[model samples]
Structures are given as structure tokens and as C-alpha cells.
Target: MIWSSSRPQLGFKRVAVVLLVAPIVALAPLDPVQAQQIPSSSVNAAELISSLKETTLQSGLTVAATTVRTVETTTNLNLRSSPSSSSKKLAVMPKGTELSVSATHAGWSQVRYGGKTGWASNDYLRTVAKAIRAGELGKTTAELKLRQNANTVSKVLTTVPKAGIFTVKRISGGFAQIIRRGKTGWVQSKYLSTVAQKPGREIYIDQKYTSNRAGLTDIYWTRVSGGDLRESVNGKILIGDIPRNSVVYRDLKLEKTAGSVSGWIFVHTQGMTGWMKTSQMSRKSTATTKPSKYTAKQVLAQTNGKVPEKMLAAIAWDPEKTLIASPALKDLNRLNAAFKKKFGKNIDIDLAYRTRATQDAYWIKLGPYVAARPGTSNHGWGTAIDMPETYDYSFRGKYFKWLKANSKNYNWVHRKILEEESPYAEAWHFDYVGR
Candidate 1:
């Protein structure tokens, strides 16, 4: 049942006359439809809004209606006797309290509680939507880190891509513990938006790609013939292929959440975006000139310092286009691949194979101590490499140490005679021991 006082702005005389002549039916239970039909001028607009709630009277024989929409307090707010902030304070509404709103004027809402009606600022009130409770799936609103712990300084285990979805296992102070792809970690709770229900199917990103989801700005090129781009890594769907040495752009953020499988990087080439194996890409521009059609054996059979340029493989990762024996190029490429993975760049090369005339010129310019006697140097064989004389390639540098230890795995090794204390020592020299 619902009841309300006079809705009109009655003066003292009119209020007294209405009280004396009002009929008992004015206090009777109301039909919901009839209640709505009653004009706003006939009932107290400040006392009634909707008739959905049922409130039992103290005698327990009658009931009153309630509102259909509710507003919640977001912080402690002053309930004022009038809509103005300077109005007299009636009470203080605590955060999270739900209130039945009867009317709104200016920027304040008139709410009812405990037989009292007052106005509150709209700034501290919000519509009642279901809170994102536990056990729900949420999607990331930005690229975020999944750390081992809930703090920003904790070890970052992986990346949660923008729009990546995960199940919320629990939430801490400012972070949410989530599980994605069978791995569990914590991410900022504020960055996740809850979903109503689980998705019908999970997305197709490979977990390895998210371990380092940062955008890449470094340029690269295709190292294989007709480097192919597939719809997915290890996927049979072929998108297209680009010729060797074709420019590729890997620093991409397409679809906000695209990813790749292990050993594959998502890239854009020839106006298409797809996956290309990491093995088939390099920072070094491949030579357009093909390796001499002759076999490595036939080239080796020729006299030292007389090998033709056509018979040699142009080092694809070398910016200077240095030539090397075809047999050694593959292993060199492997070592460079690993180096780039560790250092985020290609190795700098100062020299590779030296022709007979070039070796003679070096001997006359640098003297016997610095240059190999014309034909006696290993540089004439197209198998020795000289790294640029940069601090990174020095005997005491990190690049040198890493190369000394790991290059052997790819059949490239630094000889002991090149140590700093040895005669004719050269710290920048490395040899292809495989051939």
C-alpha cells in the first residue's frame, strides 16, 4: 500500500483547510496503476517515486510502496535539508549505503531513509550495478605485467596483452591474482574489466609470445628464399611469401592482441601480416647476388687467395657484404641468431675474406706484425672473421665473453692464440671450426 501527503505548494491556510476536509480514503492502500495515474500535483512528489517496495507499518496491518531504482553512496556525503551545499546538514551518508531516490533537482538527489528525506550531491552517488564479485573472468584494458607477486617491483613472469582475458582467482589490495593458459600470476585489478560469463572459446595466442610482448622497432629482412608468411605458426594456411632480403616490419601491435607460436614472430611484409619463423629472419640485408654456382668442394680445390667471388656466400647478416665460404655461412648465421636474441642486435663485422691483391695491400700498409704475410693468413681462406674493434668486442667485454662461451655450439670458436698475452694476439678474431 502507498500513501503520500499533498503534492501542491500549499500555504498555511490551504494546508489547514486540506487537513480539516481531507477524506479517509486519502490514507487507504493504493492500486499500483491508480497510484501512477494520480497526478504529480495530487500527491507529495518528494515522498513517492515508484511503488515497487513493500514497507510494513508498525501495526503490521498496512504496507507502503518502494522505489524501482536505487543509488549508492561512493563516499561519505552530507545529507542536506535542501538541494544547496550551504543548506543545513540533516545527516551523513556513509560510503556504500543504498538509498531510494525520490527526485533530483539541480545537482542533488532527494533520497529517503528512516522517515527522513534529504538531498545529496550527485558526485558521490552512482547507479547500482552488480559489483564484479569473485570467480569471474576479466579482460585486460591495457598491456600489463603478470608478476610473481602483487607488487610492481616483483619479478615479472609474463605479459598480459591488451584485451587478453583471464580468470580472476582472487584479488589483493590493488592487484588481482589471475590464471591464464594454465599459468597463474597477479596483475593490477584496476586494469581488468569483468565479463558476465566465460567466453565460448579461448583465443589462439601462444604463451611464449607473451613472455616478452613489447613492441619491436628494430628492422629485419628475410634470410630464406621466398620467405613465407602463414596464417598461424606451424599452420598449413599460407598467406603469402616475400623474396629473400625483403624488408619486414616486426614492431607491430596489430589487433591489440595478436601473438605467435614458439620459434615464430608475427610480422608485416609486402602489405600482409602473418607469422614467419625466427630462423628465416635477420637484421643483415641478404645479398641480391647469388652464391657462385660452384660447389664448396670445387671452390676449396682452387689455390689459396684465388677463390672467385661468385663461388662464395655473401654473409647475409653483415652490413658490409663480406664474403665467406658457403659451408660456414649457415653456422655463422646460427651464432648471429643467438647473439641477436641475447643482445637485441646483430654482430658488427670489420673483415671476413681478403682477396690476394687486398692482402698484399694490407701487408704493405700495416707491416708484417699487424698484417698476415700476403698469402700466409687464414683470412685468405674465407673462413676467419674479424669483429669491429669496439669495446663490446674487447677481451673484457660482455659480448666477447658470451661469444667465447656460446659460439662454439654453432661451430664458431675463438682460438686461444688470439688471447691478449699471446704473440700476434687479436681479440677480435673468430674462426669457423666446422669446415
Candidate 2:
């Protein structure tokens, strides 16, 4: 009972229904709106990913060229064959999609994505910056207003205090959009400083902080009468005073680990050399020609290798910031000064203090023979120091010979058990024998 179009029994009403559908399929005009127009769509996280297998667009917006770098598409954007709005579409690149930008023109960028090359709206392309596992960590240089949008005229959400640390979600133009304390907003990028934050380790980042590495050339001064520069361990062997208005320089290595956890700094002052309280030190000079009242600050004393971190100091001049017992650090400075004089370079330290947790990790990864037993090694006490396992530090190396002969004067000794003739010989191992 199928009806044919040429059948004489065909009704006028059925023919009229067919005529109505023909115009929509055959005569409808192509889509007229171009997608490249700016400020058209607000940011939408829901549309973050697009995977449109594209049919060639007959026409769309014209993209001239630009952004010769890796950028992310901020929204669902059309990838057109040419730069014009009427150009053919090559693909529908999803939001959050990365594109290799080649050239841009008239608010359009030539981009490559998903094995297809086409033009996309420059409005959706955002420049990329360095990324970290925790995202880009940054600190505000000054108290700033967090704006709802990237522009200064946008609504202010909150006032970010100076030195506030936050996660930078993305950077747009001169502004960086960040999330802090559960609120997200955009702020001037110029007032933001990127920081390298370590996981599982406490990093001391003050306003004076720069990065993970500070240079020895950095200046320091005494802010108070402070403590006597004896050692972090056994406060009895006083070397000198870090009196108020004294100038000093970091001892030994040229580069120091920035934001190190230790509260003691190994410093060398004219005619005085020892460990000082980092809390009483200032990176800025407070000394002036004008006389002012000075007050003495009491130094808190701690005992031996079992002391807390406040009693331990890092050789901040070293990039590794070798940690040691405060007393050992005082002796280390003396040894380093002499070694530097002879070799024109500071001694290289490879290993230093270790938390019990770290010791356990080493014991497992390196084996019992290679690594010190967990919780048993004097490294946990911060009294033991290990030299770099390099040719210069080897038993027969001149640096080793010079150190073996001279280090005793500084109360540091290479034990006989670690000698070349011993079964567990380690020319790099040295113990601090000072009280």
C-alpha cells in the first residue's frame, strides 16, 4: 500500500506538506553570525573542553596572524580556514585547548590544534607562563584590590594584603588572576612576584625573600646586641659578639638556599666569626651616624646536636644550605675560610643534617651499607658533614690532603675508621669534635 509521487490518488494536502519542508532544506541561508567578535561570552568553566570533528566551514571570520607561542583557548572557538568572519571552519577547538599560535591579524590568530590548522579568535587566546606542581605560586608585592575582571575598573572583590601568597590561575595582559583564601580575582601582575614553594618542607619566606637561592653577595647586619657568636651548640665557647650596628657577610659558599628552615645563620664579621640568631639579623642596615639608645638582646642557649632547628644553622652561602649543629657551623666557617684561602674556592659539602624520616628514605633507597641506618646516623644530630664525592675530595686529591692536615685546627677531624685503609673508608666523611 506504499504511495508513489506520480500516483493519481495523491492528495493536495499531502503535496502541500512536502512543499513546506523543501524550502527549509534547500533554500535556507548559511549561518550569518561570526564567532570571533570580542567580549561576547564571559568565562565559563563548564565549556573547558571541546572535541568537535569538524566539517570544513564554508566561511567565517578572517584571522590575520599572531601570538607565536603556546596559548590556551579561553572559550569554545571556531577554527576557520581564513582570517575573515565568513571563512570556512577547520575545527571547533574546545576551551582550555592549547594552540601553537603562528600569526595574528585583525583580532584573529592562526593556530594549530588537534592536527588541524586554522584561525581562532584572539579574544580567547591567553598567554601561558611557567607552571609548577602546585600551580604558579606568587606573592603580592603590595596590598592590592582583587578585581572581578582583569581590568582596574572591574568590581573589587577583596583587598589582598602585601606579601600575601596565592595560587596564580592564569595571566591575562598586565593582570594575573589568582585564588587566595577561597576568593578568586585579578590583580596587577607587576605587583606580583613568583615564588618557588617546596612541598613537605617549611620555607621561611619573608617580605625580603627573593627566590629559593640567595647570593652570598647579599648583605646582612646586626639588628640588636643579640647573642654572642659562639655556636648553636654549647653556648660556653663564645667567639665574638654580634653587637648592634655591626656589618657582616655570609660565610663560605657564594649561593645560599633561599627561605631555608634553619633559624641560625653562619656569618663572618671583621674579627668575629660564628653562628648568630637569624631573628636578630637584618638584610637592611640600621646603623646611622646619629647616636641612638641600644639595648642588649639575650641569646637563647641550646644543647649539643639534639638541639631544635632554632639552635641549628645552615651555611646559607651554600646553594644546598648545608645544615649543621650550631657549634659545628662555627667550626665549619673557620675551616672554610682557610680552605678558600688555599684553593680560591670554598669546600663543597654534599650532605648534612637529616630528619629521621629522610634517613629512613635513604636507608631504603641506598641500602644499609650505602646509607646510614635510620635514626642512628649522627646526621640526625646535625654534627656530621659529608663532602662532595668528587675527584677533588677523594683521598688522593690535593684538596683532601690539604683539608686532612688543616681541618684539625678548626675542631673538625677525619676519623681513622674512614681512612683509605679501613673497610668502610669514606674520604668525604668528617666529624666535628668540638664541644
Highest-TM-score candidate: 1
TM-score of 2: 0.32
> What does the lDDT read for residue 100 in candidate 1?
67
lDDT (Cα, tens digit) per residue for candidate 2, span 1-435? 000111122211212223333433333121222245333454322222211111233234344333346677666566777655556866565555666678765556677755677777665678664332123446677999999999999999989888665556678887888765556888888777655431111112242322222334545766675345543433543333333544555654421432223776666542224466677777755433221121101111332223354445667445445556655776788899999999999888755655554454445433543466666666666677777554577676788889899999998889897666342456777877776
Minimal lDDT window, size 10, model 2 = 1-10
Local lDDT at 415 for model 2? 89
Error of 2 at 225 (Å): 28
Task: Compute the lDDT of residue 16 as modeled in candidate 2.
Answer: 24
lDDT of each: 0.59, 0.55
lDDT per residue, candidate 1, 1-435, as tens digits?
A: 000111112211212223324353443222111334466346433223211111222121221224444677665555777665546767655555677677765546788643568877666688763333344556777999889898899988888778765556678877888765445788888787665432210111342111111234546777875467776777753433344554556744552366545687777543335678889998877553343445545656666665654556667666545567666677888899999999999988656665555465445433443466878655667777777554567666778889999999988888986654343345678887774
Off by over 4 Å in 1: 1-298
